[model samples]
Target chain A: MDNVDLLISRFLGGKSSAAEREDVLKWINKCPENRKSFFLTKEIWEASSICSSEIISEETKQWQTLAWRIDGLLQKEKIIRRRILVKQFFRIASIVLIALITGWSGHSLYLRIKSKTTNVGYEMVIASKGQVKEIFLADGTHVWLNSDSQLKFPTEFTSKNREITLEGEAYFEVKKNEKSPFIVTTRTHKVKVLGTKFNICEYPEDKIIETTLSEGKVKVLAGDKIVDLLPGMQSRINTETLDVRVGQADLDVHTAWIDGRYEFRDKPLEKILSIVERWYDVKVVYPAEMKQMCFSGVIKRHKPVNHLLDVISALQPIEYSISDSEIILKKIR
Target chain B: MLDENELVRRISDSDHEAFKELFLRYYRPLALYARKFVLPESAGDLVQECFFQFWLNRKSFIVHTSLKAYLFAMLRHRCYHELKKKAALQHYENDTLQRLRYEEWRYFETEESIFYFDLIEKTKKSFDKLPPKCREVFDLSRQRGLSNKDIAENLQISQKMVEKQITKALKIFRNELSDFLPLLIFCVSQLLLVVIRKVFF
Candidate 1:
């Protein structure tokens, strides 16, 4: 063994004979290097020992604190989730009451509309500017429509199939029914799902129709072609050619609006502004020949549209104008 | 002015005052020693834990020498266990011990044969620069693992004088070692960065 190792062993072994100990002391005195090594090792060991002791103890204390805090947070989360589930339960239970009331007061009106309608069980819901609506389908599917969007579905689905037509964007949580397949038909393609939750965005002016699947399985169909998707997957369909591309999905970004937040993950400047305009019921126009920008973050949806604009402007040099219902953006060169 | 034996006895009897005295006496040296092997944030925690353990298990304490050595031994054992736990968690890469061994072997065979010899020479020069009696006392106490009493008996000095000299020596050594801090920090930071990267990404 080297002199340092020998010195360390002699110091720590704790059973050195008197003669051996004397000999080690003699060696230490004879050479300054041996003494230096000994002192250095001792100093290092002392430092290491003290440090590890403190770290373990401090971590233990911090862990206790964190455990308590996390317990309370988890309890709060459970309560919130439970409350949401109860609200949904009541809402579903009250659907029968709504149906009964509509049937009782509007029987003649339904007869007039039903005689004019060639298709049975087909219903269309359209929301104009500054309008928000919620729909509870016969199959227990729930949809929340943003402003200026349109959704078409059947009042009651057939035993074998459930389908809907879409224009613009809608968030959906389909009730699980394996015997009957649920499909959403957009401008360019169809999303066939069996007990899955997803969002479909198919605005007419937009060039792309995006479908983001949050859970379960979904199949995106374009004419005879089909593409299957798993959870955390997104399928983007080109409105012009109906070509489809699949990629990983960021659920928090896609579903943030439903949770009263606007989340963007590297989205183009144009796309973000359009979403902001629709959700806040405003119009945003940018400079005609400016460079495009992309951003990734979350903003409170309830915040004024200008607040979000200010945040974006701080990231890059930009200016904006807000009128009664119109907002314009310009790049600062 | 109480002797080491009395201090240990009082500590073992759940004497908070004595424990606090022991803690204050050894806290600096132990913290400095621990900072050599662990991150600064963790070093403080380790020192605290060592003292806590010492207090918790004081009833079973056994000491044949200065309480300093016993506490040092406990801290060393805890450090080894901490390193072992870290090594276990990082199964994909070479551990610090293995890397040190490999470097030592390579040093023995390569043109860097005199590299460690040069380091030893530089270290010896640094030691020679210290106060003579302080160096002598530190050498005897550390190299031979002698108790302060034994050091006093052999060097023909009082035990209190020996402790004083040793404390002075440690302070000088800590100041002198500051130059090596950057290299030490780099190695530890690299290890931590690797572990964090693996776990998070």
Candidate 2:
């Protein structure tokens, strides 16, 4: 080994004096090979580590996976909140759907969003079960919060961002604010928009979040994955698996809920039951893991809960009984 | 040195990349340190537990020392718990042996263990980069503990050539390790590797 090499080794160990450090730097600048060796030694494990390259790589991959898993966990915890209000029902979306033809502001919602001023800085808008509420924000943006949903919004939009967090389902007709883009954050994603009309369905009880845009544009940012939605597109996010799927939005089917109607396009019976339970404020207990039994069609919000159940039973080979908040369903023999 | 304060700030905001940076910096040394107290099989788990707790609870830390010192201290305590747990599982007659083993580990300390593992790994890598003929001669002389004359006879080269090849390998190692600090750091690691292999197996 060269004399400079010894000096360099001493420098790397942090045991070198100022004179030794200067000598190492002088040697490094003397040739590129010396510099290369120096830098390589900094990152490269000792000679012994060379034999364990496979193990090191495997360990690196394991650590990376753990970090990502923790990232997903943190996001999930932020989105799923527990407390909910049990309030009297005020059904009014049937009229709001009719008012849809009268410009953006006049697109009446079934009066579901009830804004209760909480603290000084944030406003909590909650839509109780069996109700849908329309909210007109300070910035002329209109929001329709679905039943059993919660939205936390700042009392006033900051000069830079019109930000709000959603937990269930909502349709936003964001008043065009190019300078202040509207951002809707769920547990795992941030949907950014510059004055757009879109419906977001993210009920905690459901496994997937469905976003269907009717007008303008929105971009959903989930971790490193970004999905852009055009007016005619729908992006479905599987929360548990953290997968994003994009397809044509049967716009009417997804937006039907905002219009005070239940529209299912061959959706599974399990999902239909959950939606029914939330809409009418009742629990439907069916067979465990019943995803194969899919139901389709539209039911107006005003339809009697029993009538809907009867319609369901008649169409599928299923029988049901209702007792208080519970509706038990069994397949016909 | 990695900026612990900056990493803590980024980690508090739930930055995956920042956490990964810390993981990469300390993982191997931490794993090797844990191995001194626990079996090689469980060493990884112990190191992983230490890092997981450290990264997950970064926001709650009140750092009074360097990040490396903090991690070493955390790893030290982890190894103690691991040994204590292992002691709990073993028969009482072997209890003294295990306790003495823990003391031996503690006396050796963490810095020397990390320094040794790194030096051995670096030296082995440097040695491996030699030309095939040079590597054969040097490996026979140093690794197989063959005399220079024996290495020359085994490799069908002159004793002088064997010494030359070994010198060439040493020269390359010294040059490559020049930027590294403290030459003596390289000695114990190679010795310790053999000792560990013998003891563990």
- lDDT (CA) per prediction: 0.66, 0.71
Q: Which ten residues in a row are the worst by lDDT in model 2 chain B?
A: B192-201
lDDT of 1 by residue, A1-333 (tens): 244344344443344456655555555556545455444444333432232344346545644543454446557867999999999998987998899888887997887778656455578898675566788999899898866799998777854789889888888899999888898887678889889789987877689888999989999998677999989999898877878899997888777777678787887887777777777878777875542578887767667777888888899888887888888787887
User: Model 1: residues >4 Å from true position, as ranges?
Assistant: A1-121, B1-201
lDDT of 2 at A226: 97
A1-333 in candidate 2: lDDT tens per residue?
445544543353344677776676666556655555554443232242333554476477668767666767776655543211111112245455556555444433322222222322778999988889899888999999998998898878755888999989999999997799999999877899999999998888778888889999999887788999999899888888879999997888878887789888788887887778888888888987565777788877888888888998899787899999899998888
Q: What is the interface RMSD of candidate 2, in Å?
A: 11.2
Model 1 chain A: ten consecutive residues of lowest lDDT = A43-52
What TM-score number comes out for model 2? 0.40
Give Cα distance to truth, residue A315, candidate 2, Å: 1.6
**Number of the top lDDT candidate:** 2
Of the candidates shown, which would achieve the greatest DockQ relative to the real structure? 2
